[model samples]
Target: MTIDSFTKLYERAVDLQRLMSPFITGHLVVEFLLRKLIQIYDVSLTQHADDLKHARLISLNHNISTITDAQKDALVGINKIRNKFAHRITHEPTLADLKTLFIKCKDAFSDFTDGIEQGLSEIDGAASVDQLEEWEIHELFIQIAYDLHHVYHNRGGDIEEF
Candidate 1:
């Protein structure tokens, strides 16, 4: 196994982050992670895509023992946001949306929220739902990439960095 495959997925996520709406980008991040989990866990891919498409399902998979509880909760939160954007064309996440998402997984995400606030403090220090959403998506992507790399390395996968 090699990190090249994982790098490609991460690059796709970065590309999506640049060109797509937050909803699309966030959804893709979760989707990519789920697909990678399927590979890492050697889960059968012949099942209905919907059965394996959920981030929560990936998190709950017994073979995915590399991630922490907080990471699992974060994935679920991201999935919730993605689902909201997916099911409603008119849905634009507001401050209320952030609050709702955060509350759903408060114990797992409070530190993450604090970190976003700290990062924002270096800028204008004003907090907006849009800003929070953007930061959360960014952080989620980073975390997913990190966890994927960790799994790959632990499995004796080699990375060729150029």
Candidate 2:
């Protein structure tokens, strides 16, 4: 990846560090990575229509089989969560909403989620989804974004396979 991409991601991530809503901010970070990945396949989209919506952005990544099914579900769930927050005023994510989407990631991708849980536990005792704080939800978003980024960066190997 170019240093400019690295700088942009780092800047957005730093913004996420001070976020009040991790789901929203994490969505933004993940969206940026998605946009970059799309650019890899259709660089013209960057010049023509850069601000594609969440679902559209994700649809572009649909055929990237390198991304696991659980990863795809997490991206869709993240988009759904962002939409719910966007349309409502003063909305706090209920535990059930968090459970279906955020908790599902923990089950589907235990390896990364375990690392996330450990870090969150150290800071805020957020070891499990049972006691999920808003910040912990944000960490889940960060984890999903990093996994997409891993796929994006390593796609050269996948290209030939496709």
Candidate 3:
């Protein structure tokens, strides 16, 4: 693995680790090693179109594709929730919304992380060898970075980078 690729993964892992830091502080068990998983997604999405929304569209629109469509949907859903949480000034997220957000967060977390692990193994453990398609990698990184930012921001952490 090249230093660049390893650095990418390491950075993403640290972001994810920081994102989960809040849950850890709340006495809740955040068990998944999502940092590594997010890096894999970031690396794999390099060859697609520049528009991440389009890539997410392709993943969500296709039913028979290798990646699970529902997972992609959940990721998008979580993104929406995060946006609301981050942007809405006067609106307070209801308990139901938070509950749903938590569920989608965990679900998307499982789907993406599992996909990353399976994808890494399938490619002969070459995730850190070379970058994959651009859009795929971008989508993965954005999702991970968003989650990391969302979680920590909610708990009042000052994370300067993704």
lDDT of each: 0.51, 0.61, 0.38
* Error in Å for residue 161 of model 2: 25
RMSD for each of the candidates: 10.7, 10.0, 18.9
Off by over 4 Å in 1: 1-20, 43-51, 60-63, 96-124, 130-136, 160-162
Ten contiguous residues minimizing lDDT sum, candidate 2: 121-130
Q: Which digits, one per residue and each the tens of the lDDT, describe model 3 over residues 28-142?
A: 1111212222233443543332333433433422332323445555545545544443454223334344345445444554434443333333334334312232232233344
Clash-forming residue pairs, model 3: 42-137, 45-133, 45-134, 45-136, 45-137, 46-133, 46-134, 47-133, 47-134
- What's the number of clashes in each of the models? 0, 0, 9
Candidates 2 and 3: which is better by TM-score? 2
lDDT of 3 at 3: 30
Please give the TM-score that candidate 1 achieves against the real structure: 0.56
lDDT of 3 at 54: 31
Which portions of model 2 miss their true places by more than 4 Å? 1-20, 64-66, 107-132, 156-162
lDDT for residue 47 in candidate 3, whole number 0-100 = 37
Q: Please report, as a residue range, the 10-residue window in candidate 1 with the lowest summed lDDT.
A: 117-126
